[model samples]
Target: MTEMTRRDAPAAIRAIGHVSTLCGVVAAALIFVSVLITCQMIFLRAVLGQSTVWQTEAVIYMMIGATLLGLPYVQKLRGHVGVDLVPGLLPAGARKALALAVLSATIVMIGLMLFYGWEMFHLAWERNWRSETVWGVKLWIPYLAVPLGFALFALQLVADLWAVATGHDDADPNVAPEDRRH
Candidate 1:
């Protein structure tokens, strides 16, 4: 293992990181769109005294999509909460081992989610499922986000694992910089 940063990451890892950044941007856009729709819905219902049909359902789907699709970006930024007390106490070699183990476990879990998510999406598409609401949006469209998000998330996890294995990661965040492996 050697000391490295994202700039030193392999091309594939960097590519994944780029995609994660794109996802983050798109997630922010989705949130913005949801907010705009909510405002419009409020205006129509209150000021204009008009009944809204699709606004509520659309907002819900957009929010869920934003959350799922934002996963890879969050992982890329290491924004998720972590408990690193034990890793911080370990020596460099053991710390690296722990990072590998945790990353591997997470990848496997996300892989499962991707698999099942795709299955659900496939079923919805094949069955031509639609929401029962007045808007009657196609279920597959919203469900598509699930598998897509998990897949990107899994890719990000793989990139993270690569970083750890290659010593590109500052594995134990709780450790002092001077104490970390060089």
Candidate 2:
């Protein structure tokens, strides 16, 4: 690789890493909001003898959204479950190839997810679908998290692939030497 290209790769990786981190923060906030709403719902039911309307549905959507949005961040942290036993036994060259193959397969899977997710979100939006619950909240709004999350996840996967292919796997501080092989 040219010196300039090598220099740019790490920089690009860092930028993508920042985006993943921001997504993590957003995911955390969504969970926090869901928790707060749940607490409020409990208080309303127990103390005020009032039934909740949107709280339950809202919490469910937010929790799902949080899980979706947290994907890239989890990958970034190498928090996803992985077995390094096979890769660990391989020579450096073989290990690198394995990493490339695994990363490539992951990217393709996430891309498929992104495509279908977008399709689902688009259908819901075009049909003006709404939840059947008392809240009758718009389905597209929450459905959007599907595509958005997968897109972010694919981006992170591409970054990881690039790092591995270019011998810059250390771009992510969370990546240990053993994890890099996988």
Candidate 3:
């Protein structure tokens, strides 16, 4: 890709990244809300002498949903844990090749997760599944996060791969300029 085209190539990907970041922010807010709810539940039970029923389960579900929904944002930011020793040691060409290989593998893994996650969500929805708890929330509601998050993560990976392969982005954004030399 030419410099100009390469620059423009990432516009779409950047838009998606922005959306993923928004999701991350929303996930953080959800966790915060869950924390507040838990505190309220505690105050109600301990201070006001009331029984708590839904707070615990609701918090658990919200936390799980936040985690699942945050996957794409994490991927977009390259926030996932990774050992870069091999890439760091390799020459530039080799590093680029290795990065492409790793990104391809990740795309495959996330694709599988997206596929199966959708199946699980569909099954739950079709069966009208509900939690066994007295709250009895629909199982598919929370399960939707799995497929949605995986799909977004996979897309982000694809975009990253495209950027790298097209020379629009550095394979290792974390590596300093001097360290990239042979």
RMSD for each of the candidates: 3.1, 4.2, 3.8
To one decimal, what is the Cα RMSD in angstroms of model 1 from the true structure?
Answer: 3.1
Candidate 3 per-residue C-alpha lDDT over 1-182 given as tens digits, one digit per residue, 9 for 90 to 100: 33344467658867776888888997999899999999999999889999888899889989988998888888766679998798878887788888899999999999999999999999999999999999898999989989988888887888889887776664554445454322
Across 1-182, the per-residue lDDT of candidate 2 in tens digits comes to 22444466678887888999999999999999999999999999999999999999999999999999999998888788899799867777778888889989999999999999999999999999999998999999999999999999999999988887877664333344644333
Model 3 segments beyond 4 Å from truth?
1-9, 172-182
Indicate the TM-score of model 3. 0.88
Q: State the lDDT of candidate 1 residue by residue for 113-177, as single tens digits.
A: 99999999999999999999999999999999999999999998998898778766655443456
Predicted model with the maximum TM-score: 1
TM-score of model 1 relative to the true fold? 0.92
The residue ranges of model 2 lying beyond 4 angstroms of the native Cα positions read 1-9, 171-182
lDDT of 3 at 85: 91
TM-score each candidate. Answer: 0.92, 0.89, 0.88
Please identify model 1 stretches exceeding 4 Å from their true place. 1-4, 172-182
Residue-pair clashes per prediction, in order, are: 0, 0, 0
The 10 consecutive residues of candidate 3 with the worst lDDT sum are: 173-182
